[model samples]
Target: MKNKIVAALLAFFLGIFGVHKFYLGENLGGILYLLFSWTFIPGFLAFFDFLGLLLMSDQAFNAKFNPGIPYSVLDGSRSAQDITVALSQLKKLYDQDAITAEEYEEKRRKLLNEL
Candidate 1:
């Protein structure tokens, strides 16, 4: 997960080169920032980014940078590791005939869809 403080710091310091953009997975933005750093446009934009980061809510930040990952997964309520283990166990049960084919497919689909 991307931390707001880290992003803000990078924007404030190395934003001329778009370090925060790279950190946030905006590779194209980062490259553009690097390309235009001499022009000072990226640095100007970075200042606004720093200000925006300061004003953004944690939930909004997560929704933007960490899409597709639920808070529960981050909090360990139900994680990808747990899901993977469950899938392996479910496959074993199915292979051993502990579950019928239809039941296995239904359960597998439900688990996979969560990922």
Candidate 2:
């Protein structure tokens, strides 16, 4: 998973060459930055991008960059066993009135689908 901190650092340090843009999969923007690097405009723009990256929320960053699965899920390193345990935990929660039946069913469906 791409880290926000890493991306921000790239923008702050090597932004003059648009390294961060390339890391972010913005090939067109990276090319443009490379083309204008001689004018130092890319450097200034990269500074702003660095600030923006720092200010952006994790959810927004994940939605834009990671898509589908969030970084939190990837970071958990869940295997099939882990997913099974989680499903069991959800069932226990439902049985104990911690979660509603609909919530339990919905989460269970999602977990099963992942398998």
Candidate 3:
């Protein structure tokens, strides 16, 4: 669970020494930044990285750093198969009288709109 604010701060403050790169688990990049810290190029690049981190959406950050979550959930998009399965489950609940007809219709529309 890498935090966007933390990464941005690290990049801005300690990025010349590749602290942000290390936080992001890019050892090679961190090492390279350390190697060239004397030139100050890494500092300038780290500034850009800081800006980029600040501009990036939280979901994009999560997708990049957090593993194991489905891409559909992260992006808020769903495939036809997902919608189909969800609709079927909803239909089963409706048949079982677990949900009212009005509820079923509303939920069904919401699921379909994800296409």
Q: Which candidate number maximizes lDDT? A: 1
Model 1 TM-score, all chains together: 0.64
For each candidate in the order shown, give its overall lDDT on alpha carbons.
0.91, 0.89, 0.90
Candidate 2: list runs displaced more than 4 Å: 71-115
Model 1 CA lDDT for position 1 = 83
TM-score of each: 0.64, 0.65, 0.60
Residue 29, candidate 1: Cα error in Å is 0.6
Pairwise TM-score winner, candidates 1 and 3: 1
Candidate 3 lDDT, 1-115, residue by residue in tens:
5778999999999999999999988889999999999999999999999999999988788878766666676557888987898899999999999999999999999998888
Candidate 1 per-residue lDDT over residues 1-115, each given as its tens digit: 8888899999999999999999999999999999999999999999999999989997788899989767666665667887898899999999999999999999999988887
Q: Residues 1-115, candidate 2, lDDT per residue (tens digit)?
A: 6779999999999998999999999999999999999999999999999999999998888889888774547565566776888899998999899989999999999888777
Q: Candidate 3, overall lDDT?
A: 0.90
Question: Of models 1 and 3, which has the larger lDDT?
Answer: 1
CA error at residue 67 for candidate 3, angstroms: 1.9
